[model samples]
Target: MLSQKAKYALRALMMLAEAAPEELVLVQEIAERQNVPKKFLELILLELKRHGFVFSQRGRGGGYCLARPADTITFGQVIRAMDGPLAPLPCASVTGYRRCADCADERTCTIRKVMRRVRDAMADILDKTTLADVRGGRVDEDLLATVA
Candidate 1:
């Protein structure tokens, strides 16, 4: 399940992507526009900044903007950055793999196999779908069905 924080982060990033390049958008504005709490958004943006997904400018007429182009930043990167690994189980994770203590033989674990497939499918979609794709207003029924 996607966390509200992650959803807010994605919404905020989408807003920034739609803005003019290098345009500074205040956190308050994003909070108001996205209906995300101001304080929580502040923390989310700070985390994104640390991850190189966004950059902030302080003082007068300054705020936050994307650190790189939207097309280069995928949903996978943002989600993984904010939500940790995408795998449903640690044993099924490629990036954050950890053996389940109860599982005696992971090599033949049916549960792990299914979860790994789920993780891969998710990664395939999210990694290929960029902030650019979202910004383009291309939310077709097919896309929605696939993700859903």
Candidate 2:
């Protein structure tokens, strides 16, 4: 399940992706445009900045902008930044894998096997889909085929 914070972060990033190159967007403007709470957005933006997704400028004409090109930024990266591992369970996580406490044998665990497949499928799509693809509505045929 996607958290409210993650949703807001994606919305904010999409807005940044749509901006002119090197354009610095004010937090207030993003909050208003995206219908996100200003205070909450400030915290979210700060976290994103810490994660290297965005860069913030201080003082007059100060604002935030993408730290890298939108096409270079994957949805998986942003989601992981905002929500940690993409796997449904710790044991299924590729980046933050851990054995399930109840599982006696991971290799033979049916639940873990299914979950690992789920995680891989999700990662396949999310990692390949970038902010540019989403913003431009350019759905990859291969992705659609994979999903189907």
Candidate 3:
């Protein structure tokens, strides 16, 4: 399941991607615009900044912005940076591999095979979808609502 925290992060990043390239937006502004709780959004942004996805400028006209161009930032990167692993099951994850202890033979497990396919599908979609896609308003909310 996608946590509310992860949702907020994606929504926030989407808004930031839409922001003017040279214009930094304040955290409070993002919260208000996105309907996100201010304090929680603060922590989320801090985590994003820590991950090199965003940077903050302190001052009256300061807030946060993407550290690099949106086109270079993948949805998978943001999700992984904030949500840990993209896999539904540990055994399904390529980046954060963890086999279930109960599984006797992961090599021959039917469930493992299905999960591998699921993970591959997820990786393909997210890796190809960049923040630029979000900023350009190319998001198919229908696709996002699939796992919802």
What local lDDT does model 2 show for residue 34?
A: 95
Candidate number of the best TM-score: 1
Error of 2 at 38 (Å): 0.9
User: lDDT of all predictions, in order shown?
Assistant: 0.92, 0.91, 0.87
What's the true lDDT of residue 91 in model 3?
Answer: 96
Superposition TM-score, candidate 3 onto the true structure? 0.90
Q: Scored by Cα lDDT, where does model 1 land?
A: 0.92
Error of 3 at 39 (Å): 0.5
Error of 3 at 61 (Å): 1.5
Name the regions of candidate 3 deviating beyond 4 angstroms: 140-148
Q: How many residue pairs clash in each candidate?
A: 0, 0, 0
Per-residue accuracy of model 3 over 26-118 as CA lDDT, tens digit each: 988999989999999999999998889888999887889888888898888888888877888899898899989999999999998998898
lDDT of 1 by residue, 84-141 (tens): 9999999999899999999989999999999999999999988888888889466646
Clashes of 1: 0
- Off-target runs (Cα >4 Å) in candidate 2 are 136-142
Task: Estimate TM-scores for all models.
Answer: 0.94, 0.93, 0.90
lDDT ranking, best first: 1, 2, 3
